[model samples]
Target chain A: MRSVSKYFDGGDTVANYKLDMEIDDGEFVVFLGPSGCGKTTALRMIAGLEDPSDGEIYFDDDRVDGTPPADRNVAMVFQNYALYPHMTVRENIEYPLKVRGVPPEERDERVAQVAELLHIEDQLSSDPGEISGGQRQRTSLARAIVREPSVFLLDEPLSNLDAKLRLEMRSELKRIQNELGITTVYVTHNQEEAMSMGDKIVVLNDGTIRQVAEPQELYRRPRTTWVAKFIGSPPMNLFEGANNDGTVQLDGGNSLPTTAETSSPTVSLGVRPEDIALSTEPPDTDWTVPGTVKTVEPLGEYVLVNVEVGGSVVNVKVSHTDAGPGDPVHLTFDPEDAYLYDENGELVA
Target chain B: MSVESYLEDRLDRDVDGEKLTAILVFMLPGLTLFAIFSVGPMVYSAVGSFFTWNGFDIGQFAGFETWVATFQDDAIINWSNLRALEYPMGALPQNLIWMLVHVPLSTLLGLGLALLFADLRGRSVLRSMVFLAFTTPTVVIGLVLLFVYDPQAGIFNELLRALGLEGQVRNWVQEPQIAIYALIAGGVWVQTGFSMLLYSSALAGIDPALLESARVDGAGRFRRFKDIIWPLVKPVTAVVVIMSMIWVIRIFAIVYAAGGPSGGPGGVFSVLGLEVYQAAFSTPIEYSKAMVVALIELVIALPMAWYIASMD
Candidate 1:
């Protein structure tokens, strides 16, 4: 709810660092980054599972820096779905409430309501081992929901599911967030998951917030080159070069014209693979670069063409009918779509 | 589908043909010993209880008369001192001495040793020393205590002379009222090590998360032990209890080498196990009555053994 910074002494190499973030009410924010980015650590700090060496966390203006996990009123779903092994599905769902001393009558009523909501009423008497992975996931969801906690912490909850189940559960998770409307913080290394599921995504790297925005804004316009490179599949192609008046020059004798005002001697160039076009001859587009045909791979839907340009191999996803191995090719990428960065990997444009 | 043909086909084709025979071969030694020494004796005892016979002869049909004789004889009163009966000292009153010396004393001492050495850095050294007495030969154990309890020339009374406490150093083993307890002390010292090691391991196996959970649930230290630790250790406690019972009842060697029959002084301290020896193989062989006494012991112990097994 307010300024929270965590300084961790992660041994000699990265001796100290802080993770700072603020969450407003009812925000389905995601802490997104690659592994070892301390995104999970930050989320845990917010949930009161880990404490900050400095700074304060507030839940609607109440200092919660030292509150225990149970008293923090945040329910977490671990990546492995840490359901109680010794309990029935119903008992697993009812455990938090039972710990809080809720009466059996009210506990059962709330449990039944949640079981119905998750459609796990039939499996209530079954042990966790008897349920499918997805059903166990639902049981974990029901357990968190039955507590009616103020905050929901999801630590890569969908990462353990198979691809198909992950797809299905993503929609289910989004639906639940919409229905409950509790303030939630999700952590994941998957960019697409954060893009699709988050109302506001916090992109983190190396214990720092790289960028925080809605999905479309974060993708089309990233604040830093790390964000630009990390959030896209076959990530944004990046190279450090200098900007000429109408073109940019690479280390070897190759140059592409830039549309941005950068009179600096050094800069970084970034382009998404999807935006690059492969042509047998040069395409009559706003931007063109010479290249030698390297190779072509035919996936069922499209062809991935690799071209050696500016002493670096660049890939373009092309239509299958227009490409083959060892064909003469020129690569073209949109000039406006190019992102410029300073030497520090921060956006220059 | 003859059973032999099915078995032949399965052994010839479906099974890993060499594996079955190899496993049986590997198991032969232990299985044979178990059958001969452990299982065979149990089954033989149950079956042999139905007939009246000496150890080397053919038995006759008695149809529970042996069992009836076990209760009707005066030695039945001599076998165990039950609390319900208001009676004078049969050989029965001697076993009540076990309840006095071995019950809470050994249990508390074992628990105390386990707690004291539970966290020490050099705990294994202390444990090894305690366990040394347990591993010492029972004969040597009796001889050592016999030397310690000697009336005129013993090392203990001599130390008492050097310390000028000779009045306190009485003839401990020669006193009928106290010799049983003195011998029980030797067994207790040896046996408490086994229980302490067991309880220590039991304490370690308790889930650390359960302790944290109890703490978060507002459990204090005593409350945690009473409500959580006690129930989890109940099964282990049952095992220790049964082990004490068996060890106390079947104390053959300690009695044989320490005070023999008639308890070494007057006939003041003698329990059922030694009573059996005194009846069976002393000056006159009272073989028939000794067999009946052994039968009575089997009856008392069989129920306890069954309870221990079921608890597990």
Candidate 2:
């Protein structure tokens, strides 16, 4: 995609979308964002299901902006699977080949191959309504990949499944993409799924691409406060403070040393919950900020403690914590772990 | 604000008696009207079919005499007329022709219009214009068609004259060979709008993603409709066909209005429904015989009604 934009309602409602990106052949890229963020629109544009209001889309070396979807050699799995409810599983998988006028023997052979690959051979004769949701998903996958299209797209395909089934299909989808080696674009609001499945995650906000990088890079070095807050589970804790010399003065009347170089007087400092250490006893350094604990949530491996500092709550993840609500506590982080952002929400260092 | 808490403030006693009273209060009006209007007439006609009852006097028990007379009535079931290709066909076979011609043409035209208007700009306005005929009373539609098919003043002849096919123009309603077809065409026009509306709503209820997915799966426009859309809307087609079938079987007022109460135009436009009306209300009324014909129509319609009910 090169500078692609879309407008709805005769261009009256500008969607805030202008996309320019590339996906290498066989790369599994995930477009991650919240609802109404235009991630699905971008995917649809690539699949030729939607035409760009401006710019062009290229597949390999050919410009395909004017091509219809059937001739584009792209297949998409819709959010609901969108299986042909009237057809049997075999017929559904064989539809593309049947439409393209492939020979009976070849079509059967390909349908059987894709069905075995998706582990749905036993469901071949069953109607789509007769099968379970997970089986229907696999059948849709079979249908999409049976044509061996150069590009594949999926729009939140696992969102309708049970949590456990979603988790299982997550890895299954990744494995299928790797085996097929077709360039895939997956749209989802789930950051965890993006992190685990994407070769590179494209984080979007308000219809614009915020950052596109490896998941680990996005988590560690987010370019904007929005990305920083969006990528993490508990999210990064941010507080408004003033930067003076080589130290930052917290709004709660404490000062912490920072390594980030910034000339802005007013800045927002951030640190991930896991990067901050919580102590029941007050630390012996001025680098520590004292607060009262508001809530504690215990996971099997760690506890998320919400501490009130300067009338705002900051979450800290620790290996173990016995502090309850209203208990006084202190939080400390090394200067190297703190991130400095200018007032514009752009990363300053 | 919770349901249990809200209920706690109210007195709760006599659950069974109160529930029964509420159920009766809600069901009484609708059930009473249904029994009086629908079931009562059905039973009365059925019992009347077995007796010698006239409009004004009680007569002897007819037993199966009226039933035998229904099949023997040349106007009702003319076996020789069944082989005729021209005028003077039996009313029963004419009703069959109405089903064969009007039902499919109306439904398929409706489906075609639905597909054409599916993505067209200003579709709502176009749909309303097309549906205007259906919203009009059928008698009014018949009257309008009668004028439109008039020999001298009708625009149909003007259109034919303008197209330079002046020789094809004729008196469409008065001709014995063409009169029933003219009424059938009017029937199709009135019915297409109803089926079109039904088909439009059915098409709207389908998930658009299904079509989008098919487009991406290498299916072209015609192929997608043939495989996906047509199959999905088959239930709606069944409904339209069955309902239209019932309408064709009991067709009376439109034909009567266009051809007069005697089903004139040399009686070629007379149908079973018209024959029943003529038998009951014509001079020397055969009330029981009319009931017998009504019962035959009931027999044909009952299975379709039951089938529609079982679809749920």
Candidate 3:
């Protein structure tokens, strides 16, 4: 993909929707973003379903910007699973091969192979409307996979499944992509799914690429404040502060010492929930601030404590907390784990 | 609670007085009009089919004799030449022939045009142009057919002459052998637009994603239509067939206009509707036999009507 932008029917381009990225072959790249962020549009342009208003797309060394979708050799699984309602699962899976004039015997063999791979062997004879949503999704996957296309495009394919089924299919999809070694572009808004399944996650906001990095790198060092807040569950807590020499003073009167030097007078500080700890007494340590515990939520494996520091509230993830609401505590973190962003929300340190 | 009070509670539960009044107010007018205008004539015709009439008065009770006369009438059934399409031909077989030819031709042409115009750049203009024929009155269509199919000075013969096929040009609506086919061709022109509108709307309702998926699956345009568009629009085909069948069976205006009250040269263009009109208003006015032909048309149309009603 290269600076691919799309304009709809009335000639109005999607605001800020420009993409420029090179996805490695056999890589599972997830376009992660909120709705209307143009992730699906980008995938569609690559599939040749939608043409870019300005910019060229390449498959290997060939420019495919004007190619029809069929000649592009990209198979897409729609969010609704778009199975042919009139065809049986076997027939649906065999449709591509049939249309390509592949012999009937080979078509049947490929259909059976994909059906067994997707665990939909028993549903081959049933209509799509008669099957479960998970079965329908698997049938759609079988249809896309049976053809052995050069690239697999899935537009929120797992979104319509139930929560448990979605979780199950996430790993299954990743495993299949690993086995097939097909270059895949998956679009999704679910952050956790992107974290678990993608070889590299591309975070998008307001139709522009915010960052593209490995999931862990995206989590440990977000390139921007928007990505920092978007990539994690409960989100990264961001604070506005004034940078004075080597120390940053938060607007709420909390201060943290840092070694990075920046010319910006004001900055935004970010810290993940898990990176912060709660101490009952004011810890005599660097990067510690006094606060009062506001609320405590206990999950089986850990507890989430909301602590109020100055006029702002920050969530702290801990294993166990003896303190309840309204209790005084000190919030502490290593300065190295903390991120600093300048006035424009770009990460400076 | 007392027994009377319990009964009153059950009545109150079953029917709300205000809701009943509102239902009656909304439904009564349409129901009354339908009964008086539609059902009333049907019942009158059915009963009149069993009686003998002397112009304005009921003459005598002639039960099966009137039915026998209706069946033996040359205009209604033409018992002598049962299957022939000649002069003194039966209206029943002519109507059937019309339905068989006109319905399929119109439906196929309509579907083809709808698919052709579906994605064209200026599709709405083309669609309106095709659909314009449907809006033209059938009587006007008949007159236009007369002018177009004229053997001497018509555009059709002129084109045939220009193509050097002058040997094939003849009076299309005057010869009994080929006149029914000519009228049927005219019927197809008038009916295709309605079928096209039906199919176009159905085609619009399909999921575009399905087609996109097929396109990615390597299906070409024709394959996509055969595999996706046709199956999806099948129910609409059924509707168009039933509607066209009903229209051709009772068709009167076009045939009557082209052939006049006597059913044209050698009565080749006669249909059940024309038969009913001619029988009831001829010099002697055989109203009972007219009612019998009308009843037969109703019976033939009833199954289609029932099928359409049950579709919902």
Candidate 4:
């Protein structure tokens, strides 16, 4: 897609911005954002379900911007699965082939093969209404893959499943995509799913792409404060501070030396929850701030401690810490672990 | 109190004596009206079919002889040289032919119109214009069509002449051979809007995602209708079919208004409902025969209603 934009009602309601991106062939790219953030709009534009008001889309070397969805040879699994309730599973799987006038014998053979691969062979004769949600999702996938299209699109496909089922199907979908080797574009708001399943994640906010990078790189080096705050669980903790020369003054009267080369005075200091270290006594680190523990939540593997530092609460993830609420502690972090951003929320380093 | 007893007391509170009395009091008027007007009339008609009586006086009990005469009477049945089948033509056969023509034509045309107008601009306005024929009184429709089919001044003949087909013009309602077909055409014009409304409402209720999925699957418009939209709207189709069949079977008001309660020329457009009215209100008033004809109409309608109810 090259600078594609979409408007809903005669250019009054803009759905997407001038988004430009390239998805390499056979790569699993995840469009990640919150609700109403134009992730689904971008996916729908690529599927030819929504027309781009400007710019053009290309499939390989051919421009397919004005092509219809049927002519695009792309299959999309809707968020609801959208299975035909009246058709048996086999008929639903064979519908594409049947519509193209494929012979009955070949259609049946292909239906059987897809059904066996999806483990829905036993349910071939049953209606979609009679199947479980997971099985219905598999049937939807089977229908999409039966045509062997150039690209496969999924719109939050695993969102309707239970937690355990969603995790199981997450890997199953990846395996199927790898086996088929089709260029797949998945749209989801779940950051964890994007992190775990995507070969590359496109982080979007308000119809604009913030950053497009591999998951680990995106986590370690976010392009903006929005991507930094939106990417991680419990989120990155940002402190309003001012940078002066080679030292940044924290809001709580603490100053830390930074290697950032920018000369900006106003900066927001960002640190991940796990990057902050907590100690009962003052640590031997040059970048240490004192705070009183406000709350503590314990999970099986780790504990999250919220500390009140200069009227702002910062969460720190610790493993088996003896810290409790109202306990005085020193929060320390290495200067290299800090993300510096200017007043405009653009990353400086 | 113990927990089980306490729970039982809570459950029993739902249908206490006062509540039950209140429910009965609220239901009394509607139930009484239904029983008196609906159930009472049905039972009375069934009983009256077994007896020979006029509106004023009771006659001797006539068993199933009136029912048998409904089929065997020569006045009710006649022979037609119009078609291949040489069997006796009667009110029943006439009603069946009207059903065969009007029901399918009305339904298919209505469905086609609905599909055409569903997504078009000014759809509501167009639909209302189509449904104007249904809202008009059947008597008015019949009388209006009577002039439209008049031999001399009717627009139909004028158009036929303008088209240079002068030999095709005829008295549409007065010709015994083609009178029933003319009536069927009018019936279809009025009833098609009804079926269209039924199918349009059902089509609106369908999930649009289903259609989008079919489109993504590369199914064309006709294939989508046949495989997806048709099956999804089967219940409404059944409703439309059965209702149209019942209307065609008991059509009387239009025939009376157009042909003066005797059916058109040669009784070519006679139906069972007209037969019932003629038997009950004509000279000497054969009330038993009227009840027999009514019972036959009921028998035909009840099975279709049952079949429609059995569908999902």
Tens-place lDDT per residue, model 4, B71-119, is: 6754466644334443225677788888999999999999999999899
What is the lDDT, from 0 to 100, of the residue A175 in candidate 4?
88
lDDT of 3 by residue, B214-305 (tens): 99998889899899989999999999999999999889999999999878876777899998898888778988888899999999999999
Residue B70 C-alpha lDDT in model 2 = 83
Off-target runs (Cα >4 Å) in candidate 4 are A1-13, A263-265, B1-56, B61-75, B81-90, B144-171
iRMS of candidate 2, one decimal?
A: 0.7
The docking quality of candidate 1, as DockQ, is: 0.15
Q: Write one digit per residue (lDDT tens) for candidate 1, span A146-199.
A: 888788888898888889999999988898888988888899998889989998
TM-score of chain B of each: 0.71, 0.88, 0.90, 0.86
lDDT tens readout by residue for model 2, B1-312: 963345444536444555656756888899899999989989988887888875746577778999898887777776666666766576777788888999999999999999999999999998998899889888888789888988799988889999998998998888887788888999999889989999999999889988998899888889989988999999999999998888889888888888886676657778888888888889779898888888888888899888988895
Give stretches of model 3 more than 4 Å off: A1-12, B1-90, B116-186, B257-259, B265-268, B309-312
Which lDDT tens digits does candidate 4 get at residues A1-349? 2222222221214567778788888888999999998989888888887788877788877778788788988899989999998899888899988988889999999988888878899999999999999999999999999988888899999999999999989999998898888888899999999999999999988888899999999998887899999989899988878888888888988988888867777888899999999999999878888999999999778899999999999989988688889999999997778899988888998
- Model 2 lDDT per residue over A44-160, tens place: 877888777777677766778768999988889999999988889999999999999999999999999999999999999999999999999999999999999887889999999
Considering DockQ, which of the candidate structures 1 and 3 is the better prediction for this target?
3
How do the predictions measure up, each by TM-score?
A: 0.72, 0.87, 0.83, 0.87
Residue B258 C-alpha lDDT in model 2: 89
How high is each candidate's interface RMSD, in Å? Answer: 5.2, 0.7, 0.7, 0.8
- Specify the highest-DockQ model's number: 2
lDDT value, residue B311 of candidate 1: 74
Show the colliding residue pairs in model 2.
Answer: none
Model 1 TM-score, all chains together: 0.72
* Position B11, candidate 2: lDDT: 34
Chain A superposition TM-score, candidate 2: 0.93
